[model samples]
Structures are given as C-alpha cells and as structure tokens.
Target: MKKILLSIGGLVLLVIAVLLVAPLFISLEDYKPEIAAKAKEATGRDLEIGGKISLSLFPTVAIEVNDVALANYEQGQNKDMVTLEQMALELQVMPLLSSEVVIDRFVLVKPIINLEIDKTGKPNWELEGTQAPANETATTENSESSDGGSGAGLSGLSLGDVRIENGELHFIDLASGAKEDIEALNLEISLEALNEPLSLDGRLDWKAETINLKADVANLESLMNGGSTALEASVNSSPVNFSFNGTAQQASAFALAGALDLDVPSVKGLTDWVGAPIERQSEETFGPLSVKGQLDLNGSVVAFDDVSLAFDALTAQGALKIDSSGSVPNIVAALSTGVLDITPYLPPETSGGQDASSESTSDGGGAVQNAGADQGWSDEAIDFSGLKSVNADLALKSEGVKIRKITIGVSELGILLQGGKLTADLKQLALYDGQARGKVVLDSSKATPTTAINFDLSGVQAEPLLSDSADFEKLLGTLSSKANLTTQGASQKAMVSNLNGTGDFIFQDGAVKGVNIPGLIRNVSLDALQNSFDEAQSTDFAELSGTYTIQQGVVNNQDLSMIAPLFRLSGKGTVPMPPKTLDYRLEPKLVGDLEGQGGDSGAKGLAVPLLITGSWSDPKVAPDLAGALTDQLKDPSALIEGVTSGEGGVKLPLGDGDDAGGVEEVIEKPKEALQKLFGN
Candidate 1:
C-alpha cells in the first residue's frame, strides 16, 4: 500500500510539473494537425484552431483555447457551423488529490452558434448510427456501473461562476424559410448550491430592441430531470415590460402556476419593434395597454384567472383557457366590460356627427344622391381565415357599446368556434329602446365560406335602425322583424349573388314620405304627382306587414298588405339587392264602393294600379295607364260595348288632354260608331 501511494503521488507531481513547464519547452502548434485529425475522426466535422492554446498551474489548474471553429453540415450553405473567439475551463487543484473533478469557473467569449433543419425535416445535429433514447439510456447505465462511476462523474463536483459574453445563436428552418437570430447575448450566473438554486442575469439584442432580464430558479436539476421547479422572472424593455412568479416544469410533464404582469405603451409600436407592423385602413392609435393575470397550466392546457386587460378605451376582465392537446387548439373565455367603445375599429363615419334624421330630405332628392355616393357595402374581400385558427367558445357582456352613431345598451354576446366554423350568438341585446336576439354562423368547412343568420328584433325604431344599418331613413315607426338568411361568398357582391333567405317584417303606426299613392293612382300628370308627393303628403298607416323570400339576392314580397282609414292597399314587388333597385305594383281602392264593399280595378271607385319603379332610394310612383288600358281591354267585347253601345259601363275619364276624343280612334281605324258615342 505504501508503494502504491508513493507511485500515485509521484505521478500527480509529474503532471503538475508538465502543466507548469510545457509551454516554455515546446511549441503547441506543432501538435495542432494531430489534434484536428482526432477531433474530425470523432465528430465527422472539420476543426480549426487559429489562435493560442495554453495551460496553467497555480491556485487553480486551467486551460484556454481561442479562435476555434467547426465545419457545417453537408447541406448547410455556410462553411462554419460554430465559431468561438475564446473559451476557458478552470479546476480546483485540491479536488484532484481526492480523485474528484471540481470546476471553479467556466467562461466563453464572442461565441456564435448556427443551428438548422433542412427541407427534408432533418436537423443538422442528428448523427448517423445514433442510438435510440432507450438504447442510449441503457448504454449509459451499463457503462457507469462497469466503470464504478460516482454520480456526475468523480462525485464531489462543484461549480461557482459561469459567464458568457457577446454570444449569438441563430436557428434556421429551410422548409419554412424562417430565420431567427439572437445577437449580442451575455449571461452571468451565481450559484448557491450544486443542484438547488441558480441566480441568473441576462441581456440580448432582438430586432434592434434591447431586452434585460433577471431570473432565479430553485431545483433547476429537478426541472432538467423532468420535475417541477419554482421560478421568478422579470424583463425590462422599451417595447414591453413583463414579470412573473411561477412554478415551471418540463415540456413533457408540463405544469405551471404563476402571476403575470405586463405593460406596453402602444401595441402597434410593440409590433413594429418586433419587426412586424399591422396594416389597417383606419389611421388610429391602437393601444396603451396593461394586463394582469393569474396563470395555471398543465400539460397542453393553459388557463388564466382573474385576468384584466386595459387597452385604449376598452377595459375588460375575463377568465380564459386554451387547450392544445387535440388536433387543433380550443379556447374558451367569458368577459365583461363597461361602456365599450369600438369606434376606432370602424371605417370613418361619412356624415360624421350629423343627426341620423337629417341624412334625408323631404323631397327624397338628397336620399338618392347620398345612396349613390356611398353605395353601401364595401367591395374589399373579408378574410375569414382567423375563424379556422382555433376552436373557441367565448361569452362577452357590456353595459353599453358604441360604434359611431350606432349604440347598444346592456348587451350579452357569445361566440363559439370549432371545425372551421364560428357562431356569434346575441343572446341578449338592447338597442334603440328595444330587444334583439340572433345567431350568426360562419362556416368555412365547404369549398367556399358560407354564413347563416337567424334574428328577431322587437319594438325597435325603424328609421334609426335603417339609417344605421343600411343608410336608409325613409320610414319612421316601431318595427318588429324576424329573418333567417344564408349566403356564401368572399365579398359583398358575391354574397349578393348567392344570397338565399326568408323574412317577415311588421311596422306599426308608420308613415312613409315623398310619395302619394292615391294621387298618383288618380291619373295625375308627372308634375302634379311630384307636387303632391312632398313630405306633407306622406301616407299614414295603422298596420303595414310583409312576408318576403330572397333568392340570389332578389327579395320578392308577394304578401304585402297595408291598412289605413281611407284606403286598403295590397302590393307585390321584387327588390333586387345587387342593383339597389325596387319594382312594385300596388292596387289601392277606396274603403267603400257602390255595393258598400271594398273593390279592385273592376268594381271601381278609382281603384288604380300604382307602379313604383326606380333606384331604391328615389323610387317613382305613377298611374299605370298602359296597364289599366290592358286590364280594361282584357274583355275586348266589354271595351267595344262600353265605348260604342254604352252597355258595359260608362267610359272612365281618360286624360286631361284634348286628345280624349282621339283615344277611341287611336286603338283602331277611327271607329265611327265609337266616335259618335264620344261625340267626336
């Protein structure tokens, strides 16, 4: 035993002497080629050492290597995969006597690492003949037992300080054409225990933004071994500031609980700082934001509780969860707010701040001009791709909501998303002193996106609703309506071309201005019709109801009816949505006829068929003389007897022109008998 001990001590002294004296006796550069050859044989990559290599023996033994590089993979475009300006490892001399390896400090300077995955989805780090994880694990265990190893190799291992200065890491994905670079990274760590806690301080340059961070970890070894650890972290920067106190686990056995705080001066500015900026049509400041939340996460699921977010003029609180364990992510949330203002998200209001009622003129001229100018419904394509991004169910409530002149009071809305479909349910909506309920669903599961809306609104003001919804302000009353509609399209015009729906509407105690049906049906001239069709000549109705069906964007109203004191009107019409036009024929007759019963054109007391035709905003109403003539002559025998023999009925007065006598001759060759009956 003494001989063995003496021999080991002598060997240790010899190694110490060599470490101290070698650099002076020999040039290390002479062995560089052999060292490079061994490294290449082991790693299958080129190794270059352009700078000095040195060894020291003092309070601590140390080795330093400078200006080293490794060759890249065969598929990489660059020649070098990694390069280092300097690297050093220091060891405690006392540990060597006990057969223990204890590191005093580790340092790296100006290191650059490049990592990549190729188009074939193979990472550059993957090596040929690499053992599977199970095999690797068994091999490691067998090797350790055979070598009679202590834990972590030569047991009593300890490390004090670790420092990295001016480092860079780059990751590239050739398939996705994505490149991420982290530059000017520096890290400093102070260790308190070998396995329990680590104090970290770090900073980096990202997208020209400086990020300073600090973190403390307890049980870092446990985390590395797929277990839980406690963490506290904070980040400070110009674009955003964030902090968290949490328990974090590994990705496979994921678990997290934390409190998070975040602040941002402007969302747009923050996005720009990250090298991506949103493109929006409206020019407005998007946000000055603050957020606070309690987070709990397990596996592929994440949840936030007691969450509050304040951005711009909107303040909201919610509980939110996202589950990504499935084929696609699912998100569920419920949020509530007070006085939500969505004005900035809309297109700038054209007739800004003008009273809604003032958009129309009594003469109906301005209505046409305005409608033509605006041509409602934008032609720009609406991207619905976001609806398919995740499956979600969300509920939102607000005390009040406003978007330009449109306002809603006490509203609750729910949104559901799944399988590339999104449904928005207005479970409760109070607007314009009324209530509304509806469901709107957008589905992209088909070849093209399709939408369905089923809605009911009651006790709503007609004029304001129309003005806000469709820029129409011609009618005033309380309205009730129900509609079920479906359409498929990528744009407004496409939707119009494929629209299909059914709806019914009832207006109570309403008045429609700018046209007089009775006067126009009385065979009045155009000038006379326009004169009496002024605002003062509006027709008042006790009840007006219509049931309509829409096919291919053309709305057909076949059961249109109106009740008034002096007249009862029934009409039918087609409103073609794409052209923004209306065509209708209304048959209006007096309340009582000679038989003391209401009648149509034949039973008479000025039952004229009034035709309304024109652009929707400026329709023209006139007496259909040609149609009346056609109806009058449907029985040619009756027309011959009424004009010639005066047996069918007395001929209705034809016109205010002197050609009244010539009217009979105009139909045929100057019928002498008809001319004599008219005394022509």
Candidate 2:
C-alpha cells in the first residue's frame, strides 16, 4: 500500500511539472498577431501589440508590453492617435483551471491619449457609420470550452490589481484653445470581485507647484456606478497644510457630501482661489486661514455645516446653503467677523487735478466745508449709481463711507444729501457716544440705480451738519434730530433741480456764531422810508415771520416787517448765503400816534419813501453800525464806540434817539441808526 501511494504522489508531481514547463516552449511572438486582431475587433480600431508573454507556472500568466498603439481606421490616415507604453498584465492561476481567463493585476505606464475636435465640433474618436455589435450571448457549452469561448470574450476581462507609475495625461480642447495637463502622476489600486460587482481600493500622489497631494480612495468602482465612495486627502506645502475626507461620486456632487479641512498660511491665498477681487498693490496682508467643514449634497441642493474659517485680520465662520435648481442659482450664506479690514475692496479715488476740479464744480456753487469735529472722513463720498443689494454682517473700523447724491424718500419725508458723510460703529449701528443708534435705509426703486435714503438719526452733534456747509462758520451745542429725506433724479446737480421734500427741524441750545442777521436787517432797514409798519413799536423790538425760498444761493423773502417808535418798516430782498451779500428795497410808514403828536409826522413818513440798498460780504457789525449811526445821529463814533466797548446797548440808544427827534427826523435817522447797528 505504501509503494502504491508513493507512485500516485510521484505521478501528481510529474503532472504539475509538465503543466508549468510547457508554456516555456510556446513562442510568445506567435500570439502577437492574434492579440492585435482581437484588440482591433473589440475596439473597432487598428491595434499594435508588442508584448512578451510569460507562462512559467501552471494556471498563471503574465504579459509585459513595451508599447501598444491604437489607430482610428475610419480616417484612411495611417497615423496612430493613441498609444500605450510599458503596459503589463498579471493573471490569477485559478482561472486557467476553470477554462476561463481572469486578470488579477493590470498596470499602465506613460500612456498618451490624444483627442481632436474639429471645427464642426465632432470628436475624431466617435465611430462615424459603424453599427454596434449585437448583444452578447452566454452558453453552458462556451463556459466549459477551454479557449474562453469566442473572439468577443474580451469584454468579460476583470482586473484585480491595477497601477500607474510616473505617468502623464493631458486634455486639450482643440477648438477652444484650452489645455489641461497632469504630470508626475503615480497610482496604485487593489480590487476584488464579489457577486459580479467590483470593489476597489486606491492611492494617488500628484504635484503642482509646491503643493503636493496624497489621497486614498475606497470603493472606487462602485463610486463610478452610482454607489458611494469614500475619500480622504491631505495636502502639504510651505504656505499650506490641509486635509479633507468625504464620500462623493463626481466633483459636482462634492458640494453635497464632502468634508474639507484646511490649515493655510495665508487667507489671501484662499481668497484668490475663491474668486474675490483683492488688489495686488495693497500693503495690507492677511495671515493664514484655518478652516474645517462638512457638506451635505442632494442633487442640485447643498448644505454646509460645521464650517469655520479664521484669519489674523478677521474671524470669519459661517454656514452656507446653495440651491442651483432654479433658473438662477441662489446662495444663502451668513458670515460674521470679529474684525475686518475691507480697505482693499473700497473704490479707488479718481486721480489727477482735473477730476477733483470737475467734482468740485459739479455742485452748482453749493459749498462744502470741513467739519469742526473731525467726523473721520478720509475721502470724498462715493457715487452710488450701480450698487445692488448688499447683505453682509460687517464690522468696519476705519473712518467712514461718504455717499454723494444721496436722494431719499419715505411716505412723508424727502431729502437730497449733496455731500454728506456719516460715521458709526457699523457692527452696532451706533455712534461713538453710544447713545446714538440707528439704521439707514436707502431706496432707489423709482430709477433703477438712483439712490434714495430714509434714515432715523438721533443724538448727533448739530455742529457737524453746519460745519459741513460752506456758508456758516461755526455752530454751538449738541443736537439730536430725526429726519426722513428723499430726492429724485440721478446726479447731485440734477437732483437739486428736481428736489422736493418736507422736514420738521428743531434745535436745542443752538446758536450761530460769526453771523450778524441784525446787521443785514439794518442794511435793508425800512426806517428810512414811509409806511414801513402801521403801528408804533419800540425800535429795540423786532419780529420776523414768513416763508423764505432759496435758489442758486439767493434767498427771497416775500413778507417781512419791522416796528419802530417813529416808523413801521417792510421790505423784500435777495440774500446770498455764501459770499454773504444782499440787495434790497425798503418802505417806511409813520406811526399813527407819532403823527397825532406833531404836524411833522407826515414829513417823517414822507422822507425817503423808498430806499435802495446793497451791502458788503460778511461785514463786521461794529464798523457797519458806526457808518449808519454817523449818518443818522451826526455822531457815529460815540454810538459805535459805545456798542463796541460794551458800554451801552445800541438798539435801546437808537430807540431813545427816535423819541427825541420829530416823527419825520426820527423815522429817517432810525434807519441810519439801524444801518450803523447792523454794520450794513
């Protein structure tokens, strides 16, 4: 029995030796033509196979090809369009025993694929007029056959291990002049077949610039066929080091189910990647961005959570969701920052003196003055013409943004701001004082791009408003006011012409300094003329009430009056606020009691029934009043010196002088006294 067992074992060993050594006698060159013919029949192209086959062991096969070239046979041109070089394959030993061929390993090296799209936008590779092969058939007889059935059996090839080393791939769009190249590529793959389904594990390494990426992918085949695949990748460089992990089928689907981790040395670099316009000339630089996030994707909808990004210049972190299912993609994103420097994004000023002069002259002579309190306006107001909606939670720490031609309208109020600037703690919408807090709303609905503002301002200094104007020199006291102003039209000049608004203004402890309204009134005083006022009132007393209209810096008052002991006064005038000049005509009336007191009352009323007058710009009160008083009292120096030295009140002295003279003389001279008092 032992001898018989030994003989059986020796026979089995001999059979294995014969099976392993038989392929060594089979010449690999003899199979080249058959391999080429099989590839051509399968791909519908001319194929060149230059590879050596190895069969040193039973049921195991290996093919190493130096180069394999495929050509488009439909073109009549004999040039090879696609080439595979240094290709190799290794097969499992078990498939040979089953009369079936299954590849366990496949590898490609330096494969160059060239594709051309003609002017007609047709790719050269597409089969022009060929019919597709009929559906494949399966039979038990072919399955049992040793030669792997028929010539059409190549489709059944299954690979278990695949790798590409030191390869280069390029995509060129011929018609668009666009080219994309990937170089220095290396890849390794391991896969297995289960229930006729392929499962793969992959590792890839690539480089571009100083950046290097290493990635691991799992379930790669399933991922290509609408099943989930998981991937984790890490990038390293001097300025950047980041990692990310997620599951995705395609790049577009990354927005749905991808998680990204970033630790970059510069936020500016990230901004550049995301397409924000940051000026290259700015001196300000941002530090690194540290970000981590996860994305949930559902077709065209994507939602992001656990998103956080930080920079040295600002702290920005937020969640965002995007919907691309509509005609126009809509993005709803919320971002908040601890601090941000947005100066780089601000509009650049127009250079050269010509632009400055043009802007200065465009206001139609309305003057702008420097603020006494330094409201922190570094540049001129921006022109709000083409601005759309702005939705950002921003904290700004610079000066402030100036807006020109701010036309605003609410239901009851309308205003036009020529050149106004406002400064606020933007994050809180509060002034530095903390008491003043408000939001500004601008509406440009009427004219697509025209700006209209509706704002509620409180606890603001009134002096800032007057200081911004060219006319008034200074204003005293703190002021708080709320207004709603709007204007129509496009530009500052045009808006003023078409401007219409109504606002109620109130002042507390407000006083105008370096402005002498009394002097102006005296220069245009009606005391020199007859029938100015019907009643006899003290010269020291005066009251004014009427609607005044200003146009092109000229003020016109239609109904004005003045009362004096000897005469009543009335007049009309054109007063220019800037440059401070006026022209007027006055008529004086004798008082009834004064006429009853003496026969000369009619003479007083008759003197200078109308006086025409003009005055200098911004005249000094003391000198102007001295001139008028010298003309009326025949002793100007006394009254002028009296008021200038603070010895006596000028208005009361003039009133006493009016009582001393007859009604006629008093009425005539009081006008001179008024002229002296007002420096007109």
For every model in order, what is the number of clashing pairs? Answer: 0, 29
Ten-residue stretch with the least lDDT total in model 1:
657-666
- Candidate 1 versus truth, CA RMSD in Å, comes to 8.7
- What is the model-wide C-alpha lDDT for candidate 2? 0.47
The candidate that achieves the highest lDDT relative to the unseen native structure = 1
lDDT of 1 at 578: 84
lDDT score, candidate 2, position 62: 71
lDDT tens readout by residue for model 1, 1-680: 99999999999889878867876787778888998987787677889999998767766888888999988889985678899999999988887888766777889999998899999888776544323589888998888777542333433556676889999988999998888889999999876444658789999998788899899988666665566789899999999999989898875657879999999988888988777897544555576899899989898898999999998888999899999999889999999998887877776656543354434333432212222322555577878877777899999999999877688899999998888888999999997888999999989877788999999999999888877776666687889999999999888888887899999998887767655554443334545555545655565566678899999999999877766543456789999898888798877643322121222323223344667777755565666656755664576555454333333333332332222111222233324433332223
Give me the displacement of residue 584 in model 2, in angstroms. 16
Model 1: per-residue Cα lDDT at residue 167 = 98
Q: What lDDT does candidate 1 reach at residue 559? A: 77
Query: Mind giving the per-residue lDDT tens digits that candidate 2 earns over 571-653?
Result: 56656533345565444433322222122322222112233333332221112233333443555444344222333323322
- Using alpha carbons, what is the TM-score of model 1? 0.78
Q: Compute each candidate's TM-score over C-alphas.
A: 0.78, 0.56
